[model samples]
Target: MFALEIENLSFTYPDLTPALEDVSLQIKRKKKTAILGANGSGKTTLIYHLNGIIPAQQGRVKVLGQQVDKKNMQEVRKAVGLLFDNPDNQLFSTTVFNDIAFGPRNLKLDPDTMTRRVQEALERVGIRELAERPPYCLSLGQKKRAAIAGLLAMKPRVLAFDEPFSGLDPEVADQFREILDELVEEGATLVFSTHDVNLAYGWADEVVIMKAGRVLTAGTYDLLRDGQVLKEAALPLPLLAQLFRNSHEQPRTVEEAAALVEPGSGRLKAVDSSR
Candidate 1:
């Protein structure tokens, strides 16, 4: 079963600006999806619907085959964890440990269970040392990790993240990627919106591109071989793809591109006749 399914979904802002229009999507179970588009293209608006953050205005949204309505928002949220672009919006508790423990506490899990979950979450995010510190005192990156720990404490089956790498340093970003990989290995589905083409190109198993609050196209990495779609979505082709030139043999990462060109070579022996 798909982790999330949205059909003919539409939403408009309080100011009457259209945010999403007839957007339809299905994210498979145990898979990774990246939503890509320019600013104001509704990537965040679309993600909000995944976990009932925004009420369905004109269509249907199902989380793991269950309808997302007021009736079961609690159940739906337990199954799906959402991380916003700004950590400030999600972290409100005084202590980092308290923030992470809030969800389990609300669930009324046993004391030992709550503590175990909170400790695991902290270790998963590499913030064990900061557990007793106040979130107000943490840096932006630390706040981001603390926010993530909050979600991890819930043990959700699906994770929806908006610009998850925004506040992270390179090392921390790598740590986050490893965390995502570990989650997928444990059978969790991931859907995140990002502006980084290289990250999307190399990471996502599937990609959905949006334009003007509508889905322009979506599919596997092969979908990116069509530059017109990327252009239409106002996104640049991945840097590795641009450097490789030959679409037929494009590499998804810097290491993959390096494998094709020998070290100390003046230029690639292989040339794209199309270029």
Candidate 2:
């Protein structure tokens, strides 16, 4: 079964400001999906429907074959964990360990299992040493990790993140990527929204581009090279794709881009030497 299925989904705030309109897509099970869009493009709104955070105002949203509705929300939430863009929004307990333990505690897990789950989550996010630290004192990156540890403690099958890399330094982002990779390896379906076109191009197995509350297109990283779609979404072509487009080489990653410009046996090297 698809991890998530949305058909003709639509949503609007109480003031009638449209957040999503006639959106439709299917996210494959256990795959990495990237939702790319500019701010206010409905990426957050769409994910909210997956777990019934924002009830479907119109159309259907199904998670793992169960339709999303008020009655099913608790079940859906247990299966899907969402990490908001701001770590502050998710971390509330005095200590990092308490924050991580909060979810499993809600599930009424025994003390021993709860402790084990919290520790496992802390280790998974590489934040075990921060267990005793207050959430208020942690760095933004540390808080982000602690927040993710909370979701990990829930043991959800589907994970959603909103602008997870925002405000993170390159080193922290790389570490976050490793955590995401580990989750995927463990068979979790990961869906994340990002404005970083390069990150989506390099990391996502499938891409969905949105604009003004609607999906402009959905496809593989190859979509990154489509100027028309990028233009419609107000997104620039990924730098690697733009630089290699005319050369018949479409490198999807930095490693591939490096190889494409290698000192010998690469046309780019000769071009560079001329300058």
Off by over 4 Å in 2: 264-266, 269-275
Cα distance off (Å), candidate 2, residue 10: 0.8
User: Clashes in candidate 1: how many?
Assistant: 0
Q: lDDT of each model, Cα atoms only? A: 0.90, 0.90
TM-score of each: 0.96, 0.95
For residues 1-275, what per-residue lDDT tens digits would candidate 1 score against the true structure?
88999999999999999999999999988988999888999999998998898999999999999999999999999999999999989989889999999999999999999999999999998999999999989998899889889999999999999999986788888888998999999999999998887888998999999999999998986576667889998889887777666545677877777666756875555656567
lDDT of 2 by residue, 1-275 (tens): 99999999989899999999999999998889999999999999887787888889899999999998889778999999998988899989989999999899999999999999999999998988999999999999999999999998999999989889999999999999998998999899999999889999888999999999999989887888898899889999998878876765667888877876757666564233323
Model 1 accuracy (lDDT, Cα): 0.90
lDDT of 1 at 259: 69
